[model samples]
Target: MKQTNYYLFDWMDFDESLSKDESLWKAYTSTEVKAVDGDIHITVPYQKQVLQEDMLADTDVPQRDYILILRAYGDSIVRMFTSMVDDEMKDTGSYMLELDKALTHKPLSVEFADNVYTIKDNDGRTRARIDITPYNTEWWSDLQPGPQPTIHLTVYPDGNLAKGVELSDDHFSPPRYDALPIGFCLTEGKPDRATVSFKCEADECFVGTGERFRKMDLSGQTFYLKNQDGQGVNNRRAYKNIPFYMSSRMYGVFYHTSDYCRLSLADHSSRSVQFRNDRATIDTFIIGGETPERILFHYRQLTGFPPMLPIWSFGIWMSRMTYFSADEVDEICDRLRAEHYPCDVIHLDTGWFRTDWLCEWKFNPERFPNPERFLKRLSDNGYKVSLWQLPYVANGAEQIEETKANKYISTPTGGWENAAGTSGASNFSTLDYAGTIDFTSEKATEWYKGLLKNLLDMGVKCIKTDFGENIHMDATYESMTPEQLNNIYSLLYQKAAYEVTKDVTGDGIVWARAAWAGCQRYPLHWGGDSESSWAGLAGSLKGGLHFGLSGFAFWSHDVPGFHSEPDFMNSVIDPKVYMRWTQFGVFSSHMRYHGSHKREPWYYPTIAEDIKKWWRLRYRLLPYIIEESRIATESGWPMIQALLMHHPEDKTVWHIDDEYYFGRKFLVCPVMNGNDRRDIYLPEGEWVNFFTGEHFEGGKWYRNVEVPLDEMPVFCRPGTEIKVYDEKVDSTDDIDWQKVKTLFIE
Candidate 1:
């Protein structure tokens, strides 16, 4: 085993008692916070810890590094990076998500008072400012008094924004922040962890920590910022963990660190929104937008926008958890042709690679004997192929041994413990046997892409890049720790896969599961591992809505949830739930029918026609869907637009998490309950029901609307023109949009 000579992270996740652990201050952060040349530069004395034995095994370090630097771009957006520096900023290469520096600038005006720095606009009003109560290590008392210091950056949403209104500061922040403070605070003993608290204002709702399932109002929920394959619908932890939150306060609090963080907005801290994580340098961003859309727009501008997906990708995809053989896939394709159920792509799950799924990337000779010919057959049948993949390489796989020979696989460091310059518990990464790709290594990235290129050459149209939640420990490319690469692992992996796929096909589409802030650059990530229940179905909706706010341009979900465990071998899905899921799935950004239980229309013979009609309708909406997809690429608006994203002024839709707009117009209400009639909100203006053609005025709730198992509520806005193709085709291979009916209704 390789050895590491760096401090390991030693801390527990979400341990609430840390906030009260007031030990005599052994570590102190002395600093000078100031603005220079249109940017804020904060310098701190670096602390070097004395180790007992090996740096890897040392539980706690006496000192850690700290550097705080802040820069504002285009006014309201402020970038703050808190880094522990042994030397200076390390040169990390040209990564896509790197901050774009501003050439032209407007210097920020500041008023300094003791330890407080207030940033103001040229109009002489507070835009955003920080208050830092420095810790005093020299203070001596009866038992040596410990200094408890708090650091907070509070911004006014309407305070003289660069491109927005110059509303007064009194418009946003109420007097409640004093009682429920939201800011950053350092705890004693745990030098590597910091607790961040935000005041829970009246009607304060938090969203977007990357694809969570709880209610839209995350005010009383504890969300763990660690990605896991959580199959259960109610699991608090998610598959994609981005340390960011968009608030009703019109300001966003984002903690940009790679450590596993505990974001608690639950009753545990009912008064404040907070998160606790192992201390490294925190590079947090406080984004101020006038509206939710503006917040999301600037957020994507900071991270990165997703590339445009090909038009055909907008059509429906047919997928199942496991398709053992090529013959089975062909049969499904043949059946779809016989039944006239339109599908653009067919996804063969993990088992297609190998039964053990070691990710060898070799065709299972027994199942897919002649892989190239089989792929050609799929193309000949007018179907695009999508294969499943994960970053982890199982230990006994031949590729693992081969990569080990080439030193391509990352050294197993057992989480942050064995990582450089940090101490952490062995809690986050438990998949020890599965080795990960060392993407930072140029040789390794090319070699891995070569293997994927072989598949692309075999007619695989898309790649399902899955399971990148874990970034291997120990040293990484550029001598950085896994703590530094943890959150970014998925981003880099997707980039490599995307680059390779784009090289083969004109454009690439990856159905990714795990993501970070900038991973949206790779479009089409699915809600990870959901069960087949009404809860899971509804949970998937929340995931898409939240993820859309997180800046992903496009998102997909398993039509009828993922697994039905206890009966893994014999999976079964409820017919009504499946029907409702199909109705909602067809209306989503990218409709993909995926689950462990068989998703074939033949399986549900009773509602087979309904399922076919919905699938055909998905094909019918291809023109509109493709246009919306192009708009997503151009404007960074997700195809599945959250109700609140388009209508933030309508407060009723802010809390309504279940229903959302399909594109720029059509309202889609997913059926979650047993009743044939459910409540649907038609926002401001006349709306026409797709089924009844009855007109209704918006700005009011229409309860008990007819939404059977076969159909959910889909409403079109008045005076908007929609082009519907006269004929529904099974594929996008040959389509004539000229032969479409244009409906302009009022």
Candidate 2:
């Protein structure tokens, strides 16, 4: 085929058959290979490589740090040489080669600084840098004939340091299905603006990262990173920020650097993917394992792990946008107890303050008559209160002026222009965390923590921390740039909030929105501003499932849509929809019945009975849900699991998004369409229906199963156990563990 030699320190020349070792190099055949200005050009998939300028003439050549990149159609390995002599061009000094590929494969030679190295990738276990040589060599070996193709490079050879060679080969290794060669792929157009493309395997599906959206599969969708105000789950502006996602069938991939990057999947003519940013080289790592559980383990090893949540926050939470008066809240709690409907944490939304000024941290005296008495009454009734607050400070508020004077606010010049809406209408402002008391600054974090500590000491058990999606790219921090701080702002804010609450109460809980990669350390995030419709219910489930796959263990949503105000029995807002949504909500990590309209069970006359039934069901399943949360805190596994996570080899489970395995034991198939029957695919196991006690064999798809409006199709995997609690319980405090019923599926 082709032959090439590399001279290292005028001592060694390496030659191999390119056809025999397919793992090392890859070659593509086409009639379009041409030379332009001494550069090789190929236009099939679109790639070009050439040596433009030589820097060896300068005295800095020996001390300069150089990076050599090789792009091939399949897998390829790279080797580096140090020092070259004119006569000993075949061999001389030490050479170091780094093997970069997804599969476990070793290069021919590896030389460490201290000694010559050898590596072996046997049985998928990589053992690298086995020292083979004690000192460096400086002599070249005679070139031998080989069946494979090769390329050669000689720096300062014949006084020309930049010249290199490329050879043709008749034999080269074919590309692997899962392991793509570490090289550049074509974007099929002019390279003015860079684009990324990738191939989507016929049976494969991708999941994880980005904000929660309406569509279950993002196979053909185009996504952008710039933040906007598109509110609903289906629409664009994603509040939560996460740049890492895991593919269910293959390895979990993460782009480590915080740069503007784009991913295209099966969109081009060849269905190839191209990931590009302004940076020269892409910094990425692949976590490989056959199962989703092992993949998550490696993922958490790279990122930080999630922390444990307190036991009390596991029960039912009640929230509404307009829970104005303290007496009204007490009356509702009394009614819940009287009607045997379980309730734990009661959330007071925006109206809790007098002037609707956020972050004021004051109760409306008229509506809340006596703050201490109201809190004491709720505490006496075994319910905690969660107050809603955001990071924003109103312009005219006292805190705003104080913060500005203290340099806690972002400087005017460093702020990004608010182009989304009118200045007065848009709730947008930058908090400079660098020189100022912004979340990015240590001083600002302490300042916000002090505020939260004060609230926690005032008998508030939970804080519903909202907002944080739209952080300006120009905002400053001490050591980080604005773009770097954008996704991280929410996590830092939540950390400050958590620290403050924990300092005061010894235990803290926050219901926050907008998160990033490692934000799973903070518990309880909610889906924002869903409309009050049947479609919104489906959207909530889809969003929650998507979040669960992305490493978020705890998630919640408004039960009946936070923005709808229609009659409960209308076609779009039927009682069946409310009941079904409630069933799904209760199974989540932290259950909350919240909406713009009154979301209490008794508010809807048509669905009142159904709500009561589902409320009791939630109470009964509290033990299982709480135990699952504890497991998630310890293991980094999500409370809600995709089937593929539990079974990676079963290809059928990879794309089944509509149905998800709640926790580990229960498989929940939510009815997305307005029908009493839904189809679900079971993965290689015997399953017992939780509601009907019907047995179904797995490893196949089941269709048109009858499930009533008041019932959710929940099944337990074979050889699993679930614990059920008391149906009439108001709190989890004094529940008898011995009295719990354990269901064992075989």
Cα deviation of 27, candidate 1, in Å: 13
Q: Report the Cα lDDT for candidate 1.
A: 0.67
Each prediction's number of clashing residue pairs: 16, 30
Q: Per-residue lDDT for 1-746 in model 1, tens only? A: 12222111211232223345322111123356666765656554333222221111112535333555555656556655554323233213425344435412345567788867777655565656565655444544544223222335555533644422111111012211211121122345445554434456657678888887777767767676876655555567677777788877677766766667777653353455655665534555677777777777667766766788876787778888778898899999999988888877898887786554556777899989999999898788778988887776665567766776675767655433442322121122232344577887788889889989999988888888877776556544444467757777788888889989999987777889878877888777888777787888888888888888787778888888777746754667888878888888888888788877788878999999888888777777777787777777756478888887777767777788888888887888888876667888888888888766778898899887776576678888767777677587878875787776766756
Report the Cα lDDT for candidate 2. Answer: 0.56
Candidate 2 lDDT over 536-589, as tens digits, reads 776666677777767677888877666663543232455666777777776777
Over 4 Å off, model 2 = 1-124, 127-203, 214-217, 226-230, 268-271, 278-281, 414-437, 472-479, 565-572
The superposed Cα distance between candidate 1 and the true structure at residue 605, in angstroms, equals 1.3
Candidate 1's displacement at residue 461, Å, is: 1.0
Q: All models: lDDT?
A: 0.67, 0.56
Give the TM-scores of the predictions, in the order they appear: 0.82, 0.73
